[model samples]
Target: MKKELTADSAAAAARHARYGTLPERIRFEDMTEEVESAPGGAAASYDPEGSWKSYSCLALDLGL
Candidate 1:
């Protein structure tokens, strides 16, 4: 059989568990919602000066 409790009892149990228990913890405010998006578009997400020459290097090494 399942156990059931009234709202008052449930609240009391919750308060006891939250305050009357052995506990140590830390809490922080959520700052993600206040974050601002990047100033530029997707172009700013990458390094424009970066080069992709790894394939060429690998081909040269393998004599492909």
Candidate 2:
């Protein structure tokens, strides 16, 4: 069967492509310049804890 795609699914796919699996943490220095240049830019502080959560929450809020 062919799977249908929705906005949420597309968002999740894009997220996975960019960051791998959920709850995956990424560092500012690790991100590409284009991504870092986008709105909000990179994390100001380098807190290893909960950074993935923050990114996921923000992504959801922004509707991907």
Q: Which candidate ranks first by TM-score, i.e. highest?
A: 2
What total of clashing residue pairs does each candidate reach?
Answer: 0, 0
Could you tell me which 10 consecutive residues in candidate 2 have the lowest summed lDDT?
34-43
TM-score of each candidate? 0.28, 0.32
- Measured with C-alpha atoms, the lDDT of residue 39 in candidate 2 is 57
Residue lDDT tens for model 1, 1-64 = 9889999999999999888976555455542357677789777767646646433576778888
Error of model 2, residue 40, in angstroms: 50
Determine the C-alpha RMSD for candidate 1 after optimal superposition of all C-alphas. 9.7
Indicate the worst ten consecutive residues by lDDT in candidate 1.
24-33
Question: Candidate 2 lDDT, tens digit per residue, 1-64?
Answer: 9999999999999998998966769998788665346554466656788667656466778888
Off by over 4 Å in 1: 21-64
Which residue pairs clash within candidate 1? none
